[model samples]
Target: MKIISWNVNGLRAAVRKGFLDYIESEDPDIIAVQEIKLQSGQIEIPLDDYECYWNYAERKGYSGTAIFTKHTPIRSFIGDFHPAADSEGRVLGLEFENVYLINVYTPNSKRTLERLSERLEWEDAFLHYVQQLNAIKPVIICGDLNVAHQPQDVKNDRSNIGNSGFTDEERSKMTRLLNSGFTDVLRHYYPERDDIFTWWSYMKTVRERNIGWRIDYFLISDSIVDQLEHFQVDDHIYGSDHCPMRMTINLH
Candidate 1:
């Protein structure tokens, strides 16, 4: 199975920029989108073959998440396993026969680190929830996690040391997560590759210069590491400030 995860920034704007065309071209088995920034009944997606599950924030045009899958999951969840703070539409899950795919748009710590404490609390709760599910079945956690877990994951590691996504606290949370039995699919395959990255700033010449961070990720339980076949950063496809990432697995 092939899965694509992207922080589209805004689903409506992405569609205007040929999001549907990209989807048609890639023909992925599943698409997990973050920061949809929409409310219920706001827009109609033309996809008829896929089952679309959305978790919209209480506030319209802000944080949100959704999953479009070609296969019908036996179950789906929003805010059920996640923390109550997930009401912002930050997380959702689809339980297929073999695995549970959790799509999350992790809370950003903001430029000034003002939300860092709250984000850390959310991280602890989210990790607990993920572990609970892992005890049941292997889980594929994929999305824009909003943290650069290591120096290698960030472009300007020296200059961005205390920055929101690269802070010691934030990076430690990710480290604890990996130590808890989840494998970062990309790094597991290419641990020393520093050139690979996912999200880029909108500043002029940033994306063009490839000054980006691999904040987005696909983490799975260690038990299923062999199931992952290939993973790639699709920085070439662009519709938002962040780029899409694709992964192929042998789940079927």
Candidate 2:
């Protein structure tokens, strides 16, 4: 089975930029999106042969998430994080017969670190939620985690050391999560690959120069690591500053 995760920035803008064409080309079994920034009735993007689920933030034109799957899930969830409810529409949980697929848009600490504390709190709640779900079945967590876990995951790590997405605190939380039994699928295969990134800054020539960060990912329960076949970052396909990340797994 193939699964893809992307932060489209905005659904409307991405669609205008040929998002549908990209979708058709990739033909993933499931596609999860983050930062959709849209609500129902705001746009008409046809999703044929796919069951679409959306979680919209109360605030308009803000954070949101959606899942388009070729196969319908038996159950799903929007927000189950506590003490810091997923009011921004940051998470989507889809339960298939064999696994739990979670798509998330993690909170960013902001340029000033003003949201750092809250981001940490969110990490705790989100991790706990995943663990609880894992206890029931293996979980596939994907989307813009918003933190580059190591120097290898980002270009110019020295210059971005203390930045919101590269800070020690944020990276440490990611480490904790992985240590607790999730496999960072991409790294597991290409641990030493350099200059391979998923999200790029919108600044002029940044994407062209390939100055980017691998903030998006596909993580699965450690027990199912053997099922992971391949993982990739579709850097060449772009509708947003962030590109699509994909993974293939052998369900049988």
- Stretches > 4 Å off in candidate 2: 83-85
Question: Can you give the TM-score per candidate against the true fold?
Answer: 0.97, 0.97
Tens digits of per-residue lDDT, candidate 2, 94-124, equal 9998899999999899999999999999999
Model 1 lDDT tens row, 65-167? 9999999999989855445346789998999998999999998999999999889988898889899989999999999999998898888899999998999
RMSD of each: 1.2, 1.1
Off-target runs (Cα >4 Å) in candidate 1 are 80-84
lDDT of 1 at 85: 46
Instruction: Score each candidate by Cα lDDT.
Output: 0.91, 0.90
Worst 10 residues of 2 by lDDT: 78-87
